[model samples]
Every structure is written in structure tokens, then in C-alpha cells.
Target: MDRHKVYISSTYRDLADYRARVINFFLSGKMPDSFSLISMEGYVADDIQPSDKCVEDVAKCDIYILIVAKRYGFIPPDTTKNPGRFSITEMEYETAVSHNKIILTFLADEKQVFEEDSDPDAALLAEKKQKLLAFKEKVRLAKLTHPDGFTDAYHLCFQVQQAIFNKFFTEIYASREENLDKIYFCDRRSQNYTFQKGRQINKAIQFFLINSHEKDMAHFFVKRIGLECIESDIRTLDLFIYPTILDNSDFDDLEFSMRCAIKEEWNRNAELKKFKLKDPLDVSVEKVLSVMDELNYDCLIISWEIKSFYWKNDKLNENISAFYEKYDQVNATLKTSKKIFFIGTVSYSECADMTFAQFEDKIKSIRYGATPIKLTRINRNEIKDWMTDFEIEDNPNVQEKLLHDLLPGPDPDFYLSDLELPLRNILMKL
Candidate 1:
């Protein structure tokens, strides 16, 4: 029965009808009963000052919605030296910003400006217009407002509904439970590979599956966690992924091949058949961080090959180094608040290419407050043995057995365990 408080701020005289329409839309048709609208219409009282009441209400609001038209409504009296200069609407917006509330601004089309016979003097009107434009520019520069224009009350109502649904409903109400954990799996892979049932699941294949079909994997991860803690208070899981993408030159063909392989594998399993999947697409780190802030993710899982950290070319090395530095900053900022699992894979040949010192330096640079789980080396002899067994093995179940042999077991390396213990210690803090 929890409700979200929304404060509507605007120059009332010109936008009165538009405001009424929007409030009606939310109260009667668009939103659920849990949304409470706060506006000037509801603050009328005999003794209380309207401006003071509006500011107080805005401070308590969870979301702030501002509508701006051509007219600059009545400017409230200011007690300071700059008295009667700024509109009450502007004051409400500043109050919302001070409280760090989620603000959404809707700019009305200029053509729909309201006309009044008793309008303010010409100079005052021009100054008000300039101030409104300046305010719009400020909000736009902050990247906080949408670019769409509203021509009528109905159009404005529709825009408000869309904004509410996208930002509030999906990101907040739909997954609001404190017991629901949001987990993201970021997979940076060179190619897509298939997995065999009995054979062990390698890091590359695990990354591909986790990133490409996160919804399905959510169920799997939740079930696995449930097995470990039967009486835990956690009740739900929300999974997300950052997918892999090839450059333009190599994308078309590889994407098609990956699709076919995925379809074939999915068709073979009944449970997977019930699930739908799409090709994974690359996303920027900024976008990932934005989602984390909005959804309040509980954990993030990132896996990559060791070679991805190495580059023979100086420029490529610099680029990778810069990326990790930015990544380190972000991780440090959120370390105390969230749980992170970073897994690195090393092929036997790759490990042999570096001395102990070189390998140790690589590990130190990429640790970034993460539990670095190193996959066991895969050697040529093991590959040969697997190929030889595949030819002679008659049971269809041999593939599953081979997978079990190859995948990392429950116990990781000592270093990985050392890094994980501290992280696990803080998981129950929330």
C-alpha cells in the first residue's frame, strides 16, 4: 500500500486547464491508486501562506513535475533584496533540486500560449519570457528534461504518462521490494560458443549465456542461491546483462551464426523453450552506471579473458589502462554499497607466455576490490583427450559429463577465496 508523492509545479494562471487534465489523467485513468498528486489547487487555506505551503510540499515530494508555457504567472514576494522578481514556480523547482528529488519538466509549445487582457506590462512580460527561456536552458544543459514538445493538454497528459511509466513504474514500483536483489552480469567476449550438458561450462560460454539470456539465468541464479540459504529473507531476483557486440566489419556474419546456434540450443531444452532471448548489444559504462543508480542493483558480475587486459601495441595498452582506471574509480565509489564479482580466465598457453612477475602485476592492476576468480588452465592435451573421448563415447550424456569435468568447481583458488570473504561479510549489511 505504499504510495509515491508527486508535486506538480507551474505558472498556474496560464496552465490551469493543462494541470487539471494531467491530474485527472493520473487520478482516473493512467496511474494506479498509489500516486498522490500535490498541486496549488489543494493548498488553499485561510491562514497559511500559499508560497510557504507549496515549498514545504515540494520538499516532501518523491517526484517533481514542472510545466512551462509562454506566460510567467504571478511572482511571489521575496523577503530578501531581490523581492518580487522570481515566480513561485521557480522557487518550487529550486526547492525540489535542493532535496535531490527526481524532476521531470514538460515545455508547452509556444504557439499555445495563453492570452489575457489584463496581462503584465510589456517590459515585465519580456523579462519573464527571458527568465523562462534561461530556466529551460539550464534544465536542458543538465540533461534532466526530455526534448519532446506538448501542444495541448491531452498531449501533455500523454507525455506525463509515458515518463511516469518509464522512470517510475518500471524502475521503481515494478521492482520496489527491499528483499528483491538486482544483479547485473557484464560479459565482454570475443565470440559466442555452445555449451555441452555433461562437459564443464567454460568462462567464455558462461559469459555468453549469462549476457544473452539474463532473464532465464535469473531463475537459475535464484534457484542456486536458494539452495545455499533455505531460510534467508531474500525472496526475489532481478537480473540484467551488458551484452557483447562485434565491430561493424565483423558483426553481420557472426551475429547471424550466433543466432542460429542459440536457436538450436534453446529448442533442445523445454525450460529454455518457454523463455525468449535477443542478441546481446554493447552498452557504454555510463549507461550501465545510470541503470545501477536508478534500479539500485545489489550485485554486479563481470567476466573477461586475460588477453583482453594485455596489448602488444602501446596505444591499445594505454586505452585499456585508462578504461580500467575509470572502472576502478566507479568501483571504489560503490564498493561500500554493493557486491561485485570479477572473474578472469587464463588459458594454459597464455599463462605460460608470462613470468610470475608479469602475471602478478596483471592481477594487481585488475583486482579493483573484486574477487578475482581464476579459471583453471585449459591445455592442448585436455582438448585432445576430449576430442578422442567424443568419437568413442556412445551415450548422449557424455557431453554433460565432459562439461562437469571442465567447469570450475565450488572451491576456487586461495587468492580468490581471500578476496571473496570480505565482500560476503558486507552482503548482509543492507
Candidate 2:
């Protein structure tokens, strides 16, 4: 049998983990070992200018999987000013699309998009916001479709992931004879949840892999890629579109409280449901929603905080407001969710006594039992102790046992923050 070839497309810095994940998936023998793909790094080493390899690899692939994430701009070679028009990832995508290989795309989830307006530095944030806007435009034009009608860089990734799954899975059933006997593909995404997006994609992937040999398989693949590309390109979008707050102290206590709430919920529901915790320090709105949508948890606790100071400068006011707006937007969005507990706070260290009081007063006005929690009087030592106990590392033997049960080659390394030390430092004097 002729080995099938796949080529991956992605921004090296932003999507390195993604590339590894995809490559690992294939290498793990989930698919036939006869299948092979060009690693993005390997392709780079073989190209004329190193950068041009992405373009050429796409042209060569039987299948091209594009990993679209938040950042998709030209990565410069140390010095900045030469041939600055296109990014390596974008060029690769264009190459695949123009020559028309079977292109499958996956967008990382929205939780990956980081907002910079809350940065303590003013000049740095202005530059970041400008870049964010540019990246937003690029993503908006790239997504094939979006869920909840959002088309920002975050949602774009989700849509691409799903579309790719459908395109590839459906194509496989049409071409491969070996998989003809396979029935009832596993839909891990929806097996236990109300949401069908994940299940649909998994089914699609199963279909694509089964029918890999049909001569016209590329035709179906191309159609899916083109439609998604065009759909995202026609509309401009922004995922995080809120005003900035000028204070560093914004959302301080709120963030901590929200984290505590999430921890509480994780202990209760996630453990009961046998869900392994990925992020232990904090939980966001999306995480809560995912927990709910999947029926993994019945309750969620979330908190928000601002770490800013007033005396630093007025120039940073806009950035501060923009950061504040994100929390406000999130709070407003979760106003009606009775299952989710929301908390907000402003750090007293960065604000004047009067300003801190005013901030607390403002939060008191929120309708859904959402109000300022005055934790400033509480010692940082108390919070540190709580977090230290909260993020406890799993017992070393537990990981070994899980691996032993699976019969894997070796036990995986589990990262543990030193409970003896503070998880992280919170501002005291600011």
C-alpha cells in the first residue's frame, strides 16, 4: 500500500503545541502506521529560504491540516524590516488553498485568546492592542463558521476544527475499503453531554479515515475547505470588544473570590463526575459553560480581579478601562445563570482609599447578587494558605497507578506547585 501523506500548517510560536498534538496523535498508531505527514519543522529545514517551506509543503501534501490559532503573522528573523507583507502560516495556507490539496483546519478554543489592556504597563499595551486588532482581522477572515454566531479569532478556531473533522471523516468513507466493516464511530464529544458539536466532528473524522483511498477524495476535501475559508473571509469580527479600566486595582478581590468559588465547584462536581482537572488555579466563564453544557457539573464558581494602581499615570486609563470592560462583559453575560456563582473585586493596594471605596460602591449596584467583596482587610497570607491547599498535587503513586492501568511505557510527569511556598504573590502595598 502506498503511504498516505499529510502536511501540517501553523504559526510555529503560537501553534507549536498544536503541531505536536497532531503529530503525536498520528504517531500513537491511532491511524495506520502506513500514514505519514510532514512535520512543520522538518518542512522548514528543507525549504529554500526556510520560510518558503510552508508554501511548498502544502502543495505536496495528500492532505494539509492547518492549525489556526490567535497569532498568524510573519515571524521575523531577528531584524525587522525586510519582506514584511505575509506570515509564514498564512503563506502556507494560501499555497494549500490555491493548488487545492485536501485542507482540514482546527481552531484552538477561545479561552486561549488573552487580553492585554489590563497590563500594568501603558506603552506596551498600546502596541499589544494594535497587534490584537490586526490578528483579529486575520482570524475573522479565516474561520469557516462560528458557534453562537461569534467570528472572532477564538470562535474561528472552534469552527475550523469542526469543519475539518466533518470534511475529513466524510471523505474517508467514500474512498477506503478496509473501513467498510466499521460501524458506529465513537462520538466522545457528545457521548455524555447534550452538545453534539464534538460528536459530529469525531464521526466525521472516523468517516474520513475509513475511506482514505478514493481518487476523488480530494474533491470533497477541497469543497469543505473552500466554503469555510470564504465564509470567514466575508465578515470582520472581534471576540473581546470592551472598554479599558485605568486602575491596576480593578478586579483584584473579585478574581480571587471567583477562583475560590470555582475550586469549590470543582471539588464537588468535577470529582463526582470523575473529570480530571486541567487548570487548577483559575476558572473562566467558558470553562463554567463547558462544564454546564457537557453536564459535567451542576454548579460553577468564578471570580474576577483587577491589579492596578491610580498614581501610576493617567495615560494608562484607557487600557485599564478596556480590561475592566472584559470582566463587566463577562459578569453581564452570566447574570442569569443561577448555576454559576460570579465574584468581582478591585485590589486596594493600587487604588487610593477613596477610590477603592468608590470601586466597591460601584460593584454593589450589580443586580444579580453580584457585589464587591471587601477582602482587602484579609491578609494575603490567608489567601495564599487557601490556594496552597487548593492546588494540591496528586499523589505520585496515583499517576503511576493510572499509567500502570493503561499499560503505557512510562508514567507521565505531573507538575506540582510547591505547597510549602505561596502559589503566587498577590500585591500588598502596590
Q: Give lDDT for model 1.
A: 0.46
Q: Which ten residues in a row have the lowest lDDT in candidate 2?
A: 204-213
Off by over 4 Å in 1: 42-50, 81-84, 111-113, 116-120, 171-430
Q: Each prediction's TM-score against the native?
A: 0.38, 0.34
The models' CA-based lDDT, in order, is 0.46, 0.39
How far off is residue 390 in model 2, in Å? 44
- Residues 304-347, candidate 1: write the lDDT tens digits: 32232232224332333344444445543442333333322321
Q: In candidate 2, how many Å is residue 237 off?
A: 32
